[model samples]
Target: MGRYQCHLLCRWFFTQSLCSVIVQQRKTIDYSAKQNLLSYATESSLDHLGYMTDTPRLEAQSALTTFEFRLSTVLTGAYTIPAGTQITTGNNVIFQTDVLTEIPPGSLSGTVSGHALVPGVSGNGFLPGQINALITPLPYVASVSNLTESNSGADQEDDDNYAERIQLSPEKLSTAGPEDSYKYWTRTANQNIKDVNVYTPAAGTVEIRCLLKNGDIPSDELLEQIGNVLSATNIRPFTDHVIPKKPDKVDYDISIKYWISTDDKSRATLIQSEVNKALEEYKLWQRSVMGRDINPDEIISRFKNAGAKRLEITSPVFTVISEIQAARERNIECTYEGLEDG
Candidate 1:
């Protein structure tokens, strides 16, 4: 299937409506627990009927992916970096892609990825991808070689005032698994969303990270709002399915438990509708992995540490721009590198 599936990963996600869920399936070919469907977690069914998928998902890159865009100011010498690290303006070739000195400043080029593959990179657009250090004799083109290339005459044009807009991709767990094109999504659920693994009686568990948003909502109304989200979305309503069987005291299936948060800012970080759906679609985990349960207070504490002060879970298209701009404003020294499949 294509990277995007018809499975409604997200419905109507707007302001503070962003969310990402990591789901692992639980093993349900039990001999006994299939007989007791009592607790929301304990397995009572004989087969893995209600569960979505099985297999813990790792990203296309690392568990934690970081993408940065850097731009430096040059007063005299020329500067040429990766193609994808710059911003852009209207019909103008604002940025220069050369390695000369004294950049008059117009635009810097930037790049993002389509998948594990980086598109046609003759080095015109943002050509950064997840590649490693060291190449056999690095070479830079001192002059143009293509006749079809425009601006063959603007070699000395000023380029300081304009910014080149580039797309940037990050390293991820996608390096594993087939068709594993996935990015880290933030959750924007309510205090009710949590890691229910603690509720389980066993160790083989599913790592669940639900992101939510509570930046603008009032303290008194947060839980209620979260409740609305849960009820609105039927099957994916932050719930767990149970199946049962043999010798175990009380077997837990795939469903996790809980609600975690402490304050408004921290509480703003919860899971959203689509993220939960993505976890189901990706089927990242095996059916045997169980979900952990957590309370509101604990979830809030963790988000604060992640540098999320004012949180909202909506679809932030400019998320990449923020990183690019931050690097530009602060004048950090970073190469225009991006994500690669290897």
Candidate 2:
């Protein structure tokens, strides 16, 4: 009683109205049929690529800088020679050679932050009587590439590991059609023609418009039609027998929009029913087995995991939080005030 404040009413009313609109829009909006296809995820592209489905990968851009330096008086520190020391080509011409008892020679070194030099003699010896200095830039800075950084390509190996781990099974594939089926017979009997059934993974999206605003939730038959269209395309997995999952649990991602109108609580039921109907049809979208028998348990298990079977909602008024939780059973997976955990 203490928590049931007046301000809660306004917030509650607003939330309900907003929920109603979101659900309604989801029920009515047609995303699967939209043709403005600029880009798509690999899953979506499976439809166009057929059984030869391709997966997406990451790529990197290359960035490298080219650096250069010249051994000259202005760049290197200046050193004057005795104007007449014809240092021979192979020997003294090189800097830091076996020199006289006391002649000052020039030198060079590389720095990480400063301009680097290629490994080479900077300048050479004295030319007596010439009044010219041979600036032997002893060691110009070395280019970054020249240094042995010794990277074992750990990043490359990691990327390759990911690629190897990604299972690249085709989204669309064709095996021999059912035994004695026309597709099977025709392809098997004829060598000239290939058994390529133009396969496309189904693309399904729903727009929900509030039924209360429209006077009533759609009829069961109309809802059934929606289900049919959603599941008509191939993609949904089907199995002949139930497969046991080792972990006994699964992870999932889901989004929901709903409109709440107290004018008729019936609308919520109607929409939920519609969703169930659609899902039932989707379950039937198994690949054609032809003459081969299929496993029933596998099909059932797959159906459960493939579609979103639960509905959840939250309350704007915190006062009735417990009541909303009570309205939905734990098994039913309903939330009244919190967002779904990713």
State which candidate has the highest lDDT: 2
Q: What tens-digit string does per-residue lDDT give for candidate 2 at 1-342?
A: 345665698789989989989987875554443422223213333233322334232222111111112223233343332222221223332111112221123532221111111111122111221212223333332211112111111111122222222222322233222212222222211111211122112322222111111111222222222234323234222321111111111112222233334443445466445545543442233111111122333333432343333333231111221100111111222222222232
Deviating ranges (above 4 Å) for candidate 1 = 1-47, 51-66, 69-106, 109-342
After aligning candidate 1 to the native by TM-score, how far in Å is the CA of 152 from where it should be? 44
Backbone clash tally (model 1): 126
Best by TM-score: 1
Q: Which stretches of candidate 2 lie above 4 Å from their native place? A: 1-60, 71-138, 142-342
CA shift at 196, candidate 2, in angstroms? Answer: 33
